[model samples]
Target chain A: MRKAYSSLESLRGLCGLRICLAGSRPFKREVNSVKSRAKRLGLNSLTFPRRMYLFAAPALALFLVFWVFPLIQMFFYSFTNFNGINFNYDFVGLKNFVNIFKDGTLGNSIRNTLVYTIVMVGASNLLGLAIALALNSNIRLKTLFRTCCYIPALFSAIVVGFIWSYVYMPRSGLLVSLITLVGGDASKLNILGNHKVALYGIALVEVWKGFGSTMIIYLAGLQTLDENLLEAARIDGCNEWQLMRLVKLPLISATITINVILSAIGGLKAFDYAFIMTSGGPGKATNTLMFNVYRIAFNEQLMGKASALSVISFFCIIIVTVLMLYVMNKREVEL
Target chain B: MRKFRLKPQSVLLHAFLLCFCVLIIYPLLIVLSSSLRPPGNMDSPLLLFNQFSFASYIRAFEKMQYPKALLNSILTSGASVLVIVLFSSMAAYPVSRIKSKTSRFLYYFFIAGLIVPSQMVVVPVAQMIGRLSIPNNRFTPMIMFITCSLPFSTFLYAGFMKSVPVEIEESAYIDGAGLWTRFAWFVLPLLKPATVSVAITQGMWIWNDYFYPMIFVTRRDQFSIPVVMLQFLGDRENPAQWNILFAACVLCALPLIAVFAVMQKQFVTGIAAGAVKG
Candidate 1:
């Protein structure tokens, strides 16, 4: 009985080795077949592509459910007079769009948005470029200055607004105190009060909060520039200003394009500071298209009109983004 | 060879930068000073020298129920960041590894979310929340926050993941590791820097977001710090006391500011890297 059991165990061991060898051969064969197939079909061939799609299914599913569906719903809701409380409102075709076009508030808001975008984007990038240039030079305390400047960008817009609100307070705010200290009548100089200046005030705060980001982008771009070109210009007796204008600016064009595009989008969607500081107030001097949309939807319950405005804003963003891409692509340097 | 002279341009550049720095720091200094000042003396013109006190802090804490609000904000932000990081990384990993046209399309589809402003979807999202009978509470806001943050986090992770060499993954696959194990053991650790970036950015955003909590969570218990601060701002039938508001604002912003200051280098590096790569 013991001999028979030993022989059976040996036989089982041999069978296992044989099976392993056979399986290894088929696996190798299968791998070779795949390699040959892949070689025949290019990198993104059908069989390999099928495998990739299978892997990517989860991300695709999430995009469809969360992003695409909601966007479509937003579009559909814009067409209908849905007040959000009841989802069954009638489809008021073109009425919502017409209302926005005719509404004086909407027109004012659009104008305000454009003005805000121009001032904020323009000032922020220019200031950012200046700061970047300074840091790139042999400036002392570069790290400290960068930290201090960038700190404001980290704060929430609400917090920044609240802080600025106090600073701009007509009575005891810092700005008022500074003016008073200089023998000026501080009480009449409410920075956020003058209609003509309110938008600019808001834009200034926005630029203050945003310039750090643009500076960082510019710094990164500056780092990528070829030092040899700058040295060559220096040897040719081109001064610092000329080198900056002729060499640095053209080299960092991509970063400038990106900063402009991003800041433009941020400007059009400017809501938080304006909303919290003025609530688009002082005669709606600081009301942006987005701020108006928020007021219309939540405060006034003009859901359809608000959605229509959002669609307008959406299309505006798309157009601007496309324009930016076109302009940036056209100017892209091959280096 | 002339001795180098200080150019007017250099002096002016320094002056402008100094002015810019002052403009940036003044508001923050004011808020900090006001938060520390006694409530009764808040209307004084000289905030810097007014007898500094912490009475406003105590009052703001009591009035805003700030302890509760702080706890709520921390918990919600924590959970939201975890959800965003985990789900987004998981979803992004597959997309990054995959090389099909559909996968590329899916990648663009996710990025498209970045362009759609959160305000655009507020009405529909709010309606959906109501219709689904999702409890109008912190959890609900958390879910929405996760959804909104998913796009950016996924985009960051996918971009980072593209740089990871596939050989490590292939070796694991050959060693009998399944897809889940390969990701958990190999891919996740490799994705630490990107994960940290996504976490910090999304964490700060979710913690600081006002609109989501305002629109979704109706109850007081569910109010995040920003919402609570807004409520405090609005509770102004009486003459609004600036000291207490400033005190609350300080408390609300301090944690994030502290974290950001400590990690500013990493934060800046991560964002710059992500932007360049993307």
Candidate 2:
């Protein structure tokens, strides 16, 4: 015991000396490494018992049984003619995929999903960044305003979708009421009912419920911007716009990447608004990929085809996300 | 005159922010006011409180079976978050501490789950649930919630676990403390912030999620808050029971909003920590 105490004391003294000699973080990390190495030499212990793996067993079992196994089964089921009811099903070998494409469902849903993603990514980021900038400034009631902004985000998508549906209701909706009160023609203002406008309308609801989170993230990023750096930029006679364009945007490029990619991924999985508000409605105009999968699987009872569509969606999401991350990372480095 | 001399840019910024806040808050206020008015009264949306009453709340409360649904929501979300926090934190302990290729691979394996959208697996999950003869109960969605949340929560706890210095655990180990005791007493307490993050994020999601429950639990009694609120959707009998629908919406949102009111700072911090760090 005395020997162990002496060894630990010596190691602490060594770490102290190293900190005094080189005050850098990496240097300090090296000191920690040396101390840990000393521990590995048996002054203390570092062995994770085999039983520690049991700590991971519950989650792993759950993941394998519920998530991974299901995913694998989905890929397999996609190749077969399983209608979700019968046990006897044959492997069709790409026929389900071919059917989706041949039926125009794939093209329409993909187009809608892409458009919805684009709208969400554009609108949410812009609005969020704007609000984040405004809130980050020396504004009165800032917390109150921020909380109010986030109120919509706190509500479930069902509530948001329901409220927005009512807000966009045809004649006596809040929107139409406001437009009429402002003396605009409100006769033909049906957002959720119009095939061309339904997708955008639901996308707008998502934006409303979503931008607050984006703003919160952007605010967190902006708060990390060095005060001295901003002051230096201002001291260099840069105007507000120039400072924002030249310094702030570049500084928060990483945050922008995170926000944009998150929004895009979120937008790609757009189902709640479509499911609740429009029900992929107004003649399948708002048929997002996720909603389409739901419709195919449950409504049409074509689980095999839906599985195929899900596989396609899985690949599509992975590809789009990877591409976005790549492009955003490139822009981040350039900025 | 000096006191009134606000900068033009500052004024413009405030004005823009104020208008934006109004735009965001007005719709919510409309819902609130519509709920306050008597049922079957379709007044102008412009009216705030021409006649205030809780009649709609009473009606919505009964119709949506708010008590039962709220209990189911509370049970599923609360229990799922508890188990998720425990399991993920435990799982992260080994992944974060043990230095091995397997550990590294396991870490990335869980992280990869963040990219795979849950909808991709829903079809098979449904089929599996059916084949397994899983009952449409609260635990069904609870299990699904736990499974889905594992990856993110594990990643989060693992990130935080790295920040916890190993020396303490080593010292505890040297003091003849076993792994379970050390983890439960020392490491787990230190991971409280991570636990809270996992809880809040996963709790909010499980509480608000209707999709999984909508798919898994078809029974009316087993329905969660959001799923139960679906009754108000397209109610063809009344055609325009806006008051009851809006009232139900408010009730569905009230619990979370109430929690947010108390723990606003934590909510923001939780989100920021998850997003920025993760």
Candidate 3:
């Protein structure tokens, strides 16, 4: 059994190993397959401007009906105290919005959400930059390293939350077991149970899952960089750190901005991890605004308050995006 | 010429990268280990694969109606991708080729949707979805997915379409090719990469998305993977059969993992390009 388990571990880790081994050899074949499949399907090829309009109309109608109508509907619903079950709803002017300040869970959720966003964004970006730079150097098995790192981002956030909850589980979890092995009495320390530590614990998982995609974006930006500028900087005796600070950093500012806005919006509206792992538990430590939206709507059945919260959050997302873009645009040094 | 050599610096760099990669991959493996362990006291949290059994998987598979959930997720994601690719590509063509003020305005209008996070709509959308009499079929979520994805797809398709030379389409027009033939034969093939990009990005989004289906999919039996798998975690058998939970997790993630492994290059490129707008 021990032998078998050991072999499984070896084989499992080597999953990426086999993929890396084959990554370079099968490129043309995959493209050919896609091409052959696409080539066989040439139905109803239209080119006129009017035809273009015709083709685009269905998607537009879906957009108008599903997306636009929903936004308008939600806006009006926020002004009323509507339960999900009712046709009749009374307009309680500013009452739901007034309730926002008095709600006990509201402040904690906002603070927890900010902490999650700031910490996850900072840690993930830093880690992403480091890995991207390391792999950009003369590293062997780059494909394997990248593939392994990026595996997490491909997963749904709920899956990530579920997996990390197991990692943070006490007594029988990986962290506690490791701590116990290292001769520390860490069994008593419940990372997810302690209200103070729970949010950051989830944040750490977010970083771990998210940083890989950040690195990929950075790598893409790095690869597209003008080599001449880099070589010229190298000739000017700018060392690695200096080179990165001066040229590489400035060059990838757009990518950095994109990642920042994405991570910020992602963190602000985070629901899956809090919902799956903690369910905003240990006295509202991990409850994000988005999670509270779910709680208010479904569990508490305060449909109106939920709509109000969503409207507030929508504005928050927009304001943060605009501010971020402004700040990032200022720093951007277009070469 | 300097012969290529793994210097001390390179060695340290490789060490750091290897450690990071292991840290990233290890948690996922541990879940697989726990899932395979016999259903008993959750001991040996760091257990690699000892006492591995398929019982948890069997239990999870039966309880979650695994095959049906898988089929439902696949159907929804596939239909969403097809609708998105066909329509968004067509939408982008006019916007890309025409270069009119209306087209340019339309482009930014689609881009405008990015700022409006779907969270705002969830409440009313849920309420509205409640009223709608769509069959409990996957169509509701599929339509929602299509509507949500179009802006991003159209954005990406328009961007890529700009790079496609116009002379070919113009000559095809001059060669007496009908508008449909020219578009189908001439333009569509040229837009294949964008199609692939849109398909992949939207496919992953629809497949992995939980929020939409949770609101729209009312029936337990008709649930998608994320919604159904969530049942295993919720108020269930009071003992919290975690081995079964972990098994469901593995099963839920396997299809996506397989997709990523197969199309790593296109998926990465497509996602990176898509992320620029975010």
Chain A TM-score (model 3) = 0.83
| Pairs that collide, model 1 | none
Question: Residue A305 in model 1: shift from native, Å?
Answer: 1.5
The reply for model 2, stretches above 4 Å from the true place, is A1-45, A49-51, A333-335, B1-5, B130-133, B236-239
lDDT tens readout by residue for model 3, B236-256: 223247778788889999999
Model with the higher lDDT, candidate 1 or 3: 3
Scored against the true structure, residue A303 in model 1 reaches a CA lDDT of 86
- DockQ, cand. 3: 0.38
Native A-B contacts reproduced, model 3: 0.66
Top model number, TM-score: 2
* lDDT for predicted candidate 1 compared with the true structure: 0.79
Candidate 3, superposed: residue stretches over 4 Å from native? A1-51, A104-106, B130-132, B235-240, B276-278
DockQ agreement of candidate 1 with the native complex:
0.34
* Segments in model 1 whose C-alpha atoms lie over 4 Å from true places: A1-63, B1-16, B47-50, B235-240
lDDT of 1 by residue, B182-216 (tens): 77899889999888888876787788889888887
Q: All models, DockQ values?
A: 0.34, 0.64, 0.38
Better of 1 and 2 by lDDT: 2
What lDDT is reached at residue A112 by model 2? Answer: 99
| Worst lDDT 10-window in candidate 1 chain A | A45-54
